[model samples]
Target: MTTSTPSTPSTMRAIASYRGLPVDDPDSLQDIEVPVPQLRPRDVLVRVRAVSVNPVDAKVRSGLAPTDEPRILGFDAAGVVEAVGPEVTTLAAGDEVWYAGDITRPGTNAEFHAVDERIVARKPVSLNWAEAAAMPLTTITAWETLFDRFALTADSTGTLLALGAAGGVGSILIQLAMELTGVRVLASAGRPESQAWVRQLGADGVVDHHDLVASAGEVASDGVDFLFSPHSKGNIEAFARIVRPFGHITAIDEPEGLDLLPLKSKSIAWHWELMFTRTTYQTADMAEQGKLLETVAGLVDDKRIRTTLTKTLPDFSAAGLREAHRLVESGRTTGKVVVTR
Candidate 1:
């Protein structure tokens, strides 16, 4: 997303990609200039303080740029509100906020960004900018998956096997499930470091993801009640075997061309969640994101949940943004990487 016309009288520094090139390529990311966007009714313009890089940033950058204009690629950010649109009432200038902005809009990589107030919330008073920036996107993904899709509650009881349990979403998902519900949590991690990471985060049990059936079965002989896999491309068969009959499975990755026939026999229901869904679809419950974020902020301030910021890259330069993408693409990160202004 780019702006050809200045809605306001100013322009801002931003990192944008003119084309989808490899991360090692010099021109893959460039420091560029863009207009401070005109506010749509209900839009809140923010002075971005810090932004975090997720897998989506690398995935989007590897694809073709959407148009002739440079694409600004980022999702999660922490910032202060500079202005609000004509119809806005929930927030005003000088309010500190955090959000995973709409994927269809110009992203949070810029010095300034505009987002709908309905999906934005007040930042946690306890965290710094980098810490606040790292939580929104991954936290929202885990929150929506557990509450909105799976509908897990305090009274619910079952075993949840989390595949890819060391990544950003799983790191927080384990915390939320452990903190809020009585479910038995089994985390799948392949490496010693990743396993130790999840254990410290309070996973009830940790199993190696390789040979998930054998490993997870040792802990959950009756089969898991719920399965959450962040990487679901080639593991659907294993997912089918480990989950009990009538069990529920949810995934965030686009596991294109993977067969679901294995799941039909047991009547296992598979669901997909994109945290951006409500905002993009313009659903009546779109405002739920802001409310849930407020809840997560309360959790953070009270020290019940924590930010997953593992790495930090200073400044919003081409070098820093490129390294952030490289770390996300490497698939070796335990938590999230952030770039601070």
Candidate 2:
């Protein structure tokens, strides 16, 4: 573990796990006092006001094995800057910010968390802490999926099919595709409620994922130019059939295994979008994420895109974190669920 000369109070409240445990177990998450994190040269210390739970949170928590130290699990957070490292010039103490913090570090499930300034952005002024917290992880995933991984341009014209269109990433992706590109988006929903939700988010059309072939054919006779499959485990064959020759396919979920050989005949391209890649690898362009998030904040302020925070838990506690994890793991949530301080 890394240590630094103390410059702040020693301990703060946090929810964490010292070993892997099932979500249903009471001890799966516990309240504890941890030393306030010390900062790196490019880091910012945030006083977390709110945090939003995602599938990644549950996945990481459950996969944790026994270790000497407890692991804090959270990614999406909105907070005020409590401190900044010497090299962090973009922000200072007292600035309100939001970020999808690095997965390699202690997370936002604490009263105070330190994150690299390169991936943090100013919070959207029009949104409250909970609302702002809901956007970072999902927004970064959706943005990189459409524009970065797929290399889509504003003038590109085609049909896009988005599977699981009511989930956090899908909900935001549907809106961004409509607002940022010329593509006609055809979102797939399994339930009527999800269908209505995607339409409300401005999908050009909605289709039942069960009858993907027929539903997608109605929208694009020649097949969709792009397929965005957030849940791709059982839908790869369907995607290959409905996607046009030479089209692109992108996914974010952890499918068991993919057989890409089937896509060869049509010369289709497939890409994976993991938003954590940039920060995890410390890429040369990591700072681009902060700039892009700033752009997203501006879009929110202009009302061109809206926050997808559909639910908010009362406060950051063991009970609240457990419930949030259960809701996300249920796989029925329509948008984002947040826990406020």
Candidate 3:
């Protein structure tokens, strides 16, 4: 038998199951030895060095959620490529890389993960495994929401309001909106710490989401040109109340229901930013994900965009995974939480 390297396992440990189940059931996570996946023509096998948890991971863990068998539960990751498929030309073995793996495949929680070349990108040279691990999901989601939904141009100039600017996507979203866009950026954070968090990210103004209509009106009487929400329901009317005529509102949260009619009077457009949709749908621009991630990595490398890792667990373990879930579920984290190799 071949010996396993310290960083590379011949058969690695992963949180998985023979049957689907919920993470809360205690039977949710099982340590098992599984063969490292062989790369397909367009695939890369990464020796996962670190990972971060997202809400979707927990949701997918429970049999309550639908997915193929023996599913792995992670999304954000930073790793070292140990092997590559023949057709892969962009990356080779030992490249440091990061990615938000497709929801269609096993996740990065494993010691070794096989992913599509189009979905992976070179990791930022400046960050350690844990810090780099904090980025992929939130960065991709935030970048797509601002540039894609808003169609924000380089020259676009207007006051932009970001709702819920303390969470994972919101934190990075605030930073990019302030640094990259010509728009004068404002953000909402209900508590003092949350308010201060956005300010450190360079928000020019802050409002409370508790009563966005009134709170935002104080900042922009005629309403801001853009309203971005990373929070949940009850903000649609507030968004409608404070968005300029013909403006745009983008939200990552899955609001139970929204009254689109409220935006009708102002001719305002509403955009739903779901980062998984493109991969889930196999869109024409699916490959754009790799390109965008590469761009984000360049920014991180230059310190233009910062790594958002707020918490780090020393190793990848079920207990560690559960703690990450608890923090996310609390909805109080300021940035990302990561678990490193």
Candidate 4:
């Protein structure tokens, strides 16, 4: 329980949830007034400047049951800190920050939102509100998978395959692996434009996603050392084949009927990363997320890496937010879609 409500408004405008309607329905996402969230001991109130629409936003909105509560839907955000809770130490009012918020909490689709300081970090100085907003969720997933789960080092050498390389997470994963590690990534993108997009992001090679194993084989004859599987449902067996014996795979998608039997025989280790894991369970090392973000921020400022923002809506208008959602739902979008202030 923390005090300090004077600078905060009693209510804020936000985009409300779909009540289980399809994206085409104009009523699916609408403008609504919701009370500003209260802060916890370690919470910081962010005056959200921009938010990016992720696939989960569409999935959650479409699956959401009818509710009297306004379920705001967004995760990635970049904004200024308006207020801090009593126990907040790392951030303060007026400090700009960015974070992909916890899925368990009411989201960042609002004008104001509250998040734990441990998971929030200084916004990259090089990127604007929209560009900065485009990262966070994907960046966290990529950073955690490559550095934390796989324990990759700068001296590490091997061929890494990024399946679905044009999507948000894959887009960043390609850049991070190329910039931070000795391993070269063969980015898998089905479309020519997508292949070009990933290559522009510093990918060492690009493979067609339609024939993942065959395309990847052309690049890594002995199979790859690491596979970044953003969508692993129907491709588990293919992944096991592409990965060398005792190789590693990192997955972010939740696919039904997932079978990992193929990997068991090859001793391929599977690592799953969810950016919300830290904030949802309040892990002891949660602040490590902030530190990593800070590190990436430096890389961004140094121009060694870049933001994946490709589409931008001018403002927080409901129509714009819905359009962003529709674009993401279309499944053809490359990089990230952000609605900015």
- The local distance difference test score of each candidate is 0.90, 0.90, 0.81, 0.90
Give per-model TM-scores.
Answer: 0.96, 0.96, 0.92, 0.97
- Model 1 scores worst on lDDT over the 10 consecutive residues at 1-10
Ranking by TM-score: 4, 2, 1, 3
Please report, as a residue range, the 10-residue window in candidate 4 with the lowest summed lDDT.
Answer: 1-10
RMSD of 3: 2.9
Global CA lDDT of candidate 2, please?
0.90
Off by over 4 Å in 4: 1-7
What is the TM-score of candidate 1?
A: 0.96
- Candidate 4 deviates by what RMSD? 1.4
Candidate 3 local lDDT, 236-292, one digit each (tens): 666777888999888777766666788899999888888888778978888789899
Clashing residue pairs for model 4: none
RMSD vs true structure, all candidates: 3.0, 2.4, 2.9, 1.4
Per-residue accuracy of model 4 over 1-341 as CA lDDT, tens digit each:
46554778889999987488888788889899978888998999999999999998888989999987878889999999988899998998889999999989989989999999988999988899999999998999999989988899899998888888899998999889989999987899998899999989999888888988788888888999899887787888888888999999988888887889989988999988888888889888999888888889999999998999999999697788889989999999999999997
Give candidate 1's error at residue 163 in angstroms.
1.0
TM-score preference between candidates 1 and 3, better one: 1
What are the per-model numbers of colliding residue pairs? 0, 0, 3, 0
What is the per-residue lDDT of model 1 for residues 1-341, given as tens digits with 9 covering 90 to 100? 22222333488999998888999987888899988778898899899999999998898898955467988889899998888888888998889999999988889999899999999999999999999999999999999888877899998899998889899999999999999988999999999999999999899999899778899888888899999988888888888889999999999988679788999999999999899899888999988999988999999999999889988888688889999999989888998899999
lDDT of 2 at 51: 97
